[model samples]
Target: MTLRPALATTLALALTVTLAGCIAPAAPTPEPEVSDGLAPFFEQGVDWTECGEGVDCATIVAPLDWEHPAMGSIELAVSRIAATGTARGSLLVNPGGPGGSGFDFVRDSIRYVASADLMEEFDLVGWDPRGVGRSSAVECLDGAAMDELLFGQWDNAYETKAWVTELEAAEAEYAAACARNTGPLLEFVDSGSTARDMNLLRALLGDEKLNYLGFSYGTFFGTMFAELFPERVGRLVLDGALDPSIGALDWFAVQMKGFDDALVAYLAFCVGQGNCPLGGTEAAARSTFTNLLDTVDAKGIESADGRALDSATLGFAIAAALYSEENWPALTSMFEEVAVGESFIAFQFADSYYGRGGTAEYDNNSFDVYTATLCLDDDFQGDEYDVRSGLDAIDAAAPLVGGYFAFDDYAHVEAACTAWPYAPKKQPGMYDAAGADPILVIGTTNDPATPYAWAKSLAGQLESGVLVTFNGEGHTAYGRSNGCIVETVDAYFIDGTVPTSDPNC
Candidate 1:
C-alpha cells in the first residue's frame, strides 16, 4: 500500500459451493464540486482486430457499480489466446497487481512465461482490473510529480508529536495531488467491483465454473472470487496469496520486516558472492547501505533517468530490487556501483518500482487504487495516538526503514479518505475467506514485498489454508525460478491435488 501492489493465504476444505446472494452498492456518491465527471471511453464487444498473431480483443461492460449494472459501465479490456490444440475451456489468468494490467501483461508475457503445456490445454485470458491499465485507467499526478511524492520522502521515524505533524502535512500534499488528477472512477474502484467484473468475464467466456491462476495481489482477487462465488471457482491457483484482513499499517509494517528478513539472507548469499561489498558481515553491508543513503541524502546522485536519487529514493530502490532473486544480482550490482560511486543502480531500481523509463509515463491506477482500497480495507484508526503506536511498531519492526516515514504512510492514505467518496462496504475482514476452498498459501522466508510471516499467520486463519514455504526471497513464489513451486502449482491446477504436506523450497 505505502509501497507497492503486492501479494498470500490459507484455507479449509468442506466448501459448500453457493453464491452468497448480494446486491449492488447504493446510488453512487454524488460528484463533488471538483468532480469533472469525465465518462470513460472504451470499446465493448468481441473483436479479433487487436491481437498480434492469435490473440483477440473483447470488452466486457460491467457496472460502474455492480449493484446497478445500468448506472454506468466500466469497459474491461480483454485478451484471449484460444486453446492452442484442445479446449479445457478458458483459463483466466491474472498477474498479481491489484492494479496489474491483465490485457497488456498476458498479451506480452503469456507467450513467454506460460509453459507450453499450459498453453495447449487452456485458452489464456487476461483483463485489466476495474480502473487500471487499459480498462478505464486511473492516473494521478504527472509522472514527475508521482516520482517526487512516492519516492522522494525518506526517514521512517514518525514517533515524535512534531514528526506526526509533518507526516500529516506530507500526506495532505500527496492526497491533494491525487484528488486533483484522479477523476470519478476512483470512488468505485474497490476489489469487490473488480471481482464482479471477473464474474462477468466468466460469463463472457462461457465457462461453467471459472478456471483461474491468480498471482500476488491477483491471489487476493482469487480469494475474493472464491468467497463471493465458491461454486464458480474451477481449478484455481491462488499463488502468492495475500491475507485481505491485515490493515495497511500491519501489511506494510510486515513488508518492512520482510525486507529486513530478505536483506539478511541476501547478505549471507553475498558473503558467498565474490563481488559482494556488503556481503560477509551485515554490519558492513548495513554501514555501506547507510552511508550510501547518507551520501545521497547530503548530496543527491543523478540517476540513469537523470532524476536525483535521495536517501529515501535509494532506500525504496533497494527494497524494490530485493523483491526477487532475478533482481538480486542487479541490486547488488547496483549497490556495488554505488559502493564504487556510481548512481546508475539507484536509477535502475527507481525505474523498476516507479516504472519510469524514457518511454515510461504516469498511470496512477495502481497508486490511486492502492490507496483507495487500502485506506478502506485497512480499517485504520484515525486517532493520532493510535498512529503514534503504529509508528513505534514500525520503528520496532524496522529500525532502519521505520519511524516517521512508514507511520506517515500508514496514517496518510486514510487521512484524505476522511472525506473520501465511499465507506467500507464489507467489514474489516480483508483476510477472511469464509466458506473458501483449500487455499494454497506460499511465502518466501525472506520475501521483502508481502513478507512470509503474514502467510504463516494467514494460514492459521483460513479454513483450509496450507502453507508452502520457500526458504528464499522475492514477491510471489510462482514467477521465480523455483521448479518445485511451479510444478506444485501446475499439478494443483491439473488435478485438484495439493501437496500432501507443505514442501520446503
Candidate 2:
C-alpha cells in the first residue's frame, strides 16, 4: 500500500481569484525587449476568438526550451472570460497541479473558482503551462495501460525487498514510457521554464506587472516567478502555499502527517454524528482503518466493474476523500459498502481522484505531468534503503498512513529518476522575493495537502508578505464557505489593502 507519487491531486482543485476596479483605459505599454533570446515569444500576439459562453480561446507560442531558443517552440493553450463591466486588468488564475488544466478551469469552472465581483471586474485569464493539459502535454501510456499502472494489485508487504524491487521496476517502466512518448519536451517541463513562460504571458497580456492568484503548486510557480522577476511582481496572492525549500522526502512526510491529522478530525466528526462504523474513539477509528487496510491487502474485494479493491486503491480512495470534509459522507458510504463486501463506491472515489472516466479513459494527463514536473523539481537522491530508514519516524508521527506513504518506492523520486531519461534541473532552496510589493499568503489551519507551517514559512520568506490565516479544514482556504477568509482576500485584491497584522479567520 505504498502511496503513489501523485499526492499533488489533493491540492489539484485549488482555485484563486483577483479583484479588479474599473479604471480609464490607458494606451497599451510597448512590449518589453526580449533579452535572453526570447524576442519571438515576447512579440507574439494571441488571436482571441469566442470558444465558449463568454470565453475567448487563443494560443501563445513559447520556446520549448527557453535556454536554447533555437530548439523550436511549443504552443500554450490560453483562455479568458472577458470582464462584464469596465476592465481593470487581467487576473491570472492557476488551479494548482504542476499538472492541473488552468485553461479548462477558466473556460468550464470559472463561476465556481472565482468570486462574482472578481469575475465582473477582471478579465479572468487562464493558460495550460507547457506539458500540462491542452498545452504541449506530456504523453505516456495509453488509457488502459495507465489504468493498469495506477490501479494494479500488489501483494508484497510494503518496504519488503520484493515490494521495493517491484515498485522500482514499475516506476522505471512508467518513466520509459513517458520518455518514449513525450520526447525532449519532458526535460523542459520544470517549474523554472513555466515561470519564464508566465513572464512572456504577462508581456503578451499587456500587463506591466503581474497580478496573479495561485493555489497549491501554483503558489510554488508564483513564488518562482516573483523570485525570477521580482521587480514585475504585483498584486499576487498565494493560497495553500508550498514551501519551496523542502525536498521530496520532507514534503511527503509533512503531507502524510497532515492527511493523518485530517483523517482524525474527520473520524471525530463522523462519530459525533452517530452510527459511525469506524467507532467513537480516535484509537478505535484508527484500529478500524488499519484493519480495513489489512483486510484489503490480504484478499481484495470485487468491485462492481469487476476491478479489485486492493489496499493501494483503497488507500488512495481514503486519501482523496480526506481532501475536503464535505466528502466525508461519501467516504463513510464507501467504507460501509466495503464493510458489506461491495467495492464500487470505493473504486469510484479512487477513480475520481485519478480522473478516470466512466469507460476507464483518463480525462487528462494530470498524473503524467505531475510525475514529470515533480521528478524535475524534487531533489531526492536516495535509494530504497534510505527510504526504509526514515519510515520509523514517519510512522511515529503519522501512525496510520505513514507506513503506506513513506515506504512506497513509487513515492521516492530518486527511485524513478535514477533510471529516468532526463536529469532533474531545478535546485531546491529558499525563495525571497526581495523587491516585490506586498503579497498575500493564505493558509488553512487543517489544510491536508500544503500544511499550515508551509504558509508561515513562505510568507516569512517573501520580503513584503502579509499572512492571512483561515482556521478551518480542507485543502485550500479561499472560496470555501468562510466569509471571513473571502472578505479579507477580496478586500486586499479589490482595494489594494494589505493587512497591518497577521489576521486569523
Candidate 2 at 41: error in angstroms? 0.8
Query: Candidate 1 lDDT, tens digit per residue, 1-505?
Result: 4434432211111222232332221122122221123222112224444445566666656668666544676768887777778877788888765666677666766666566667777889988887777787665667666666665554443245775566566666665665566665666777777776777677656676788877777777777777777656666766555667666666767767767776677776776777577645767777765565556655655665556566556666767666666667777777767766578776766565555656346533566666666554545545233556665677688766432235325555645455454565564344455666677777777666666776777676766677888776677776564788877866776667788898887
Please give the range of 10 consecutive residues that has the lowest summed lDDT in model 1. 7-16
Off by over 4 Å in 2: 1-33, 382-387, 390-393, 405-414
Per candidate, the number of residue pairs that clash is 22, 0
lDDT of each: 0.63, 0.76
Tens-digit lDDT track for model 2 on 297-412? 66658776667777667776777777778888988888888888788877777777667886669888877887788878764443343445556556666767544544432354
TM-score of each: 0.82, 0.92
lDDT of 1: 0.63
Q: List the residue pairs that clash in candidate 2.
A: none
